[model samples]
Target: MTRRTSKLDRRLVAETALRLLNEVGLEGLTLRAIAHELDVKAPALYWHFKDKQALLDEMATEMMRRMAADTAAPPSDDWRDTFRTRMHGLRAHLLRYRDGAKVYSGTTFTDTSYADGMEENLRVLVVAGFTPRAAARAWLTAYSFTIGYVIEEQAMGPDPFAGTEGYDVEARAQRLAAYPLSAEAGREMFQDHERGFDEGIGAIIAGVEATLLRRGA
Candidate 1:
């Protein structure tokens, strides 16, 4: 019923930090802030996490745990379809909180619970005729694309596409009147991120199929 407890643990601290993250965002979230939200002294958090970054790493791990729970099993085994589904699911997971992508990026996972899932992902590629190294590279490429996309998406606003809040094609066109094509291009580029995301994943998968799978590389 209460976030406060007699004993503070790493998981509780991480979960509290995640809830606070939505309220304060990454720039405002801090170990002290999390402690205050938990109704504990700042020093109590240090017993579980050595520092703020350590706490952040745990939070990212917790996010991954929730993501994994949403997909009980991997998707279909057609390598391209499987990867596309994974990338989309990953994007949804990263969009779950304020600055979710920023919180997830560059953090070392705190445990090995992710190993089985990673192995399963790589196995799908390998079974589809990718060399182990190529499979790893391909997966990483897709992952990097999703992370970068979501970071920019969150930057635009909580709901970048609800209206023309951050990406007003007309405004962009007006600002770049000297270049009609680049100005109008904003509609294609920013007007429909869902389409862009699907196309981007498709293009990446197609490229991998053309270059790696085709060449047996």
Candidate 2:
């Protein structure tokens, strides 16, 4: 079936932009491309979004909206566990499209869906003994860490050097022959990224709990 985008809504435009993001990434995403996908003239798109940035902002908002939906129903009552799970989930969602984290980072979401989720999650923390401000801070702290982490992890894309992004003990050893200790450190540092991600998030959650508990958050 042919899709008609003659009368477009912001949501429809944003959703189309998201599909383009998965296919062409952020750099290739353009108003013209979106128009082509929607089967409409590029000028018709401006009726919904003023410029690419406006469309991008809507895209970012839509990503958050999806994230909010994913985390809507908390599986656990333990605030720590809930926060940790959601952080991991957010990372997974952000990694879905190329430069997903960058897209989200570029714009602010001015939607109530995100706002409502924030308020509800903040209440969870507040009830768990965190002051209102502390609750917000704690969530933001986790959010910042998650986004930053996914950004870094995703940045190591497509084997930047010689198509050897996987385990290369021999190649690495030969490269670091002059510096044994540095090579060992590098090996350990880069090896087992999944473990590192898991541990890093675990530590963040534990650290937050300890700090907030000590300060009576």
Clashes of each: 0, 2
List pairs with backbone clashes in candidate 2.
129-217, 130-217
TM-scores for candidates 1 onward, in order:
0.92, 0.83
lDDT of 2 at 21: 78
Question: In terms of TM-score, how similar is model 2 to the real structure?
Answer: 0.83
lDDT of 1: 0.84
- The worst-scoring run of ten residues by lDDT in candidate 1 lies at 157-166
lDDT (CA) per prediction: 0.84, 0.77
Task: Summarize candidate 1's per-residue lDDT along 122-197 as a digit string, tens digits.
Answer: 9999999999888998999999999999888788653533323565668879999999999978777775677889
Candidate maximizing TM-score: 1
- Report the C-alpha displacement of residue 10, candidate 1, in angstroms: 0.8
* Cα TM-score of candidate 1: 0.92
